[model samples]
Target chain A: MGEPLLVQSPGVPGSPVVTVAPGWAFAAVAVLGALVVVAAMLDGALSARSAGGPAGGAARPFGEVARLMRQRRRTTVQADSLLWRIGGAGLLVAAALMVAVVPLGRWTIFDLDVGVMWFNAMDVMVWALVWLTGWGANSAYSLVGGYRFLAHGLGYELPLMFALVAPAIAAQSLNVGKVAAAQEGLWFAVWMPVAFLVYLLGVAAFSVWGPFAPALGSDVAGGVRAELSGVDRLVFEAGRYALLAAGAAFSVPMFLGGGAGPVLPDWAWVLLKTLAVLWLLVWLRRRLPAFRPDMFLEVGWLVLLPAVLVQDLLVAVLAVWRT
Target chain B: MDMSPGGIPLAEGGEDRDGLQLDVLKVRLGPVLPHWPAGLVLHCALQGDVVTEVRAEVLDAGDEGRDDADALARALDNLVSVLALAGWEGAAAQARRIRDAALETGDRPEDLEGLERLRRRVRRSWTLRWSLRGLRPLTEEEVRHHGLPPDAVGDTYDRLIRMMDRAATGTRQDDRPVFRVEHLALLVIGLDLAAARLVLASLDVHELQADHTQHEVAHG
Candidate 1:
């Protein structure tokens, strides 16, 4: 028989909160970073293959990193180097902070009361982080790319926040661990399809990878990150993939019943689910086209917002009925 | 809004539809843009990311090549850039692969088959059509007067379809290049930078290389 899960605090009975050694937190971050790198490598190969170029192969992403590292740093005249550096590094920091709350099996660094809100706040931070990187460059194209990201942010943020509400409401707690625990019997995703769909959209938007990638769109010549070169480009690229990986990992707890699976350790289940979600998000890029900001705004406000609200309403009613 | 040292209006102050004062900033796209046609520059006066005034010009006259193989290679290059802008990396890569194979091996059967499959997939993509449909619709007069290739005489979608068809067939039939340098400035004037890029890509504005040579010939 497995030992009873250790509770961090004694105040609440039957709470899903668990405590782990401090070393595990660092190990989790390292593992997540590796997963992100793998996802990015796969993404590069996928993009290359799709474009009819030679497949990036196993070593292409690694080779790209080396090439970028050796390239000399290029700077614009009158550019705010300080702000630009901050903006470049901020993405990785934001991703790390967001991922900190995500549970790996029964362990998380901080199982806070408002993990859902924390995740939302970190994503919103990405909006500012991208704009700052663009504006800091003082180049017209980069600045415009920054503006595009903000426009995209306006379209996706509210609906994304609304989608987050469904899981929190069903669990009757804002804590992510509790939400995952609530799904032990039946996953919320099975019932809350609309919210799940909107959440996926939100994931794409925050990561700026697939259809929602207007900020870094090629139309603006690489958008907000257009001016980046050398180490700056490398760090930013890593940060982007990390953010994407974190988004997919967070989805596991919120909708996919977290670590709950048959015949596998909780950590293994979390890893498997995270990989599945990450693969899905990356695959979608080739399947969909980037949406025009104006079109996306209209859809976000008119369609996605209303649809997620109704999903939230239904979840609320169902929660009450079950109670 | 500020004036430059040369007495040029660096940032023009303007009023929006809501009567709010807007700061117009001058931004340049390309001559150095990624996934953009090489040696093309766009000067834009933007009022809150909307292009209120725009100008297009060629910075460098490209290498002149008119052979059938070069033409196909150039067409594939254009296809690559356009697909990149559309964010269709898979199809764009396929085009590149076929183009490379055609040039290196002289239209191998396998490469042609791959190109055919790619054409079907791109043509069948509703997402591609949704992204491209009705954008930069051309009047029959404009298309004819420009001497555009017969297949390229419609919207961006039509041009893309034509490009795909030629790519699949590995055709050697010379389609008259229909690019007028002045039309670029005209077409991009009111469009936002993103739409402007799509229009330029669809037109394969690089085909204006021929027009540039003609201009140089007249001047020389």
Candidate 2:
């Protein structure tokens, strides 16, 4: 059956049951707690510069947005109303809350039993917020950004829905926490490699990385953020880091061994995994060329969609064959 | 390193520009008096007497609302011109060939249809919409009901070309304008008439190299 069985086969004393691991989700929560400062830097990656490269592994997080906040804000006099300011602040809040439910290292702010459904809802919400931020600014650049975000919404959203479902088939669980726990015998990345990679790619596309980063890039001259400044800009930037942390958390439990590690505490392993993934993403930004949105949309609908569907099917076969 | 907008990387064997050594810088001067004589904004770098790098960004007679697609295209055209001036030889000549051939494809017997055809091909790539976010032109309906003229769409090419020539020289690093006059202009005259003037103005722009010092259409 296609139905996901999140709580299954009560394993006791040597046999573990497929139940949602509530404690593990907090491992990701701790990481989010730590990144609250760096995301506030508006130009941290450039003039501000993040110093946490391998040589300075123990150094502080980047903070460009914070410095910008201290500067006096500027606004175009032709604004029809104060809607842009309100809209900017509102959308940032919405996106921050959306990141709350998404599990990092199996721990989210609070994981509901319907983990897959929660994540999907949050993504759709983010789509709306980005559009709002784009539209509210009233400037031409912001209008274009809002519309661009909607197009990106079209490209990555559905494929992500399919990719997240592969583990549900293997474990018969919709609870992301449960799905992570089931990775003890084998990490989903081992058996469901396509879903793992596609999901990361999808996440990257959603988050505006690699070739999919036409929005808010140097080329567009900070497309959506073209007009934003001060504290409002800081919040928007902060929300991005939170989202990144949340994505790393969700993927870790599914693709890697979740909290499974040797010698180190489970939570420490989770932190290491989160940092590793975050580092990998930053590295990709420096290494790969930016892709056009049209190119990725074609890739998403044509190639990634079909591949993830097949991977889902394979996981189904394996589930039945093993049972 | 010859560019007008996004500047050049001076570091040797830099990974950018596909590992090419040339570099250029984009500089914005300021909100202008409009009466002031057009001055040149020079993006200068030297690799000996051959003049290895220079890019120009003009403040222009006005502004091109901060758009990346617009900026990149302006940068691209500027880069080509700067390379030619710096003794790259065939660079400027090759650009003129493409622009001239494109000029023919655009001219037709009818006034309006001829203009629309040019907007589709020469102005910018509609397919480019998929490549860059937020630069897509409004549909005929969206543009019209808003009271924008049919030709106003072509004005983007005009504005970009104008920027190629003037924005580099006229705008200083701090020459920030509250808004471009053209944005307000489109609101007044409508698009088709606006588009014609812009197109006519741009026709010669591609043929000659950009020079802010000389305002005369034909320059040395």
Candidate 3:
């Protein structure tokens, strides 16, 4: 029962993952892009269904890309162009960097020891990137949108950090592969449900997806993306979907028993699990309302923080007893 | 010190709600913004996203009175705005569909059924309820003071449900007074931009007319 789910390939002797060559990073990015596309397509279809349109909404993403690509780049008065571009482009990079530590099945690129913390750091980088995107626009609405994200960050970040601690505590190792390995028969999500739920909320929060999307609310005229136009808007939006996809991918190892399944190969299971999670996140967008930053701050601090902390405590006690 | 960068005047400093001196930037919330009243423009003095001061105006408010035929559709359209602002896209889209159907086909039974389903769904949404609850509650006196309709008596959430009810029943009460553009500036003061937008959307100001007279809301 404790045997490794997938056979480790030849590379590092003691490591749970084989460090694939640098060229494989492109393949990883392609997978991330595919997940992003699928999520976008699904969201488009759902939107159309709700709006009483035919199933033709799946093609909306492609149409939008073409339209944006051909459109002119918009610039604001006194806009800090460099920082804006960086913030716009940095989300995809952060998502890429996060997946660097995530082991696919038996193979992983850049098998860092503290992979969980690496993923955490990348998410924290989102705080800066989104705000920078907001600030660089030099528009009043965009700036307000940026501040709203920071307010949400203050609420979600702590609880998210503690949620990460649960798996690390139960596994007694910060390494994500090791953590996945520790969950031989039991997934962390099944036992520490509070942490799992908070982690999902955190993922949604950091991705600026669904309920945590007041930063891009319609009232603020697209909020952070208020002034973004042309290819710049396209890239910024792609980055958001990519972040959501990456978050779902990372959760496989952290919570859902990574690469652990029957009949199908390990990599296939990982992809399937990721697709399921990504679909859930995208579907959730239609179901919930936006969380008001001020009201959410209280819920984050009062409810989510305490609940996840208790989950971590329970996991900690169980880990110690097992040892 | 008068300095204009990129032809825009620099923001002036003012005491914020926290008693800290902060830069107050003048920003306009649209006559053309999405989900906003069609011709209303709110010129505001913002200190860190909070509306410290405001002035309201409306553009192109012609002599033509309200279109009584489209009142139900307009009510549904306002519901769409409130739902969309609340971040419930599915429900917003559902409301939009019903609204569009109402506009196209008038009082179809299918549209009415859809509206009923949407009303129940929105009411059942604890998340939506939680998000909209207790935001900008206007008492009866406050409503009268603002010259707003009696329907605007409750908080944003209550107003939202009442808006749904208004759409469902198609009851345009004669006692319900017209909402002028000037009242917007007064109502939105002291709230942050998002909440202010929510409050405005909840009012379902279908009969709003342009009042060219500029009225300044006192800075607290």
Task: Report lDDT (CA) for all predictions.
Answer: 0.79, 0.48, 0.86
Q: What is the Å distance of residue B29 in model 3 from its true position?
A: 1.6
**For model 3, which pairs clash?**
none
Q: What DockQ was computed for model 2?
A: 0.05
Model 1 over residues A1-323: C-alpha lDDT tens digits?
24344547443346576755555667767977898788878887777666555665556788899999999999887788899889998988998888888887887777777899999999999988888899899777788888777888899999999999999999998888898989977888888989988988888887777777767877776778889999999999888888988988898899999999999998789889999989998888877767776567877999999999999999999999999
**Model-by-model DockQ, in order:** 0.45, 0.05, 0.79
Question: Candidate 2 — which residues are off by over 4 angstroms?
Answer: A1-30, A36-63, A76-109, A219-221, B1-208, B211-220
lDDT of 2 by residue, B79-143 (tens): 33332222122233333333333343432213212223322332253322222222224456744
**In model 1, what are the clashing residue pairs, if there are any?**
A50-B90, A51-B89, A51-B90, A51-B93, A51-B94, A52-B93, A52-B94
Which one is best on lDDT? 3
* Model 1 error, position B203 (Å): 1.6
Sorting all predicted structures by TM-score, with the top scorer first, yields 3, 1, 2
| Top candidate (DockQ) | 3
True lDDT of residue A109, candidate 3: 76
Global lDDT for candidate 2? 0.48
Clashes of each: 7, 52, 0
**Superior candidate under TM-score, 1 versus 2:** 1
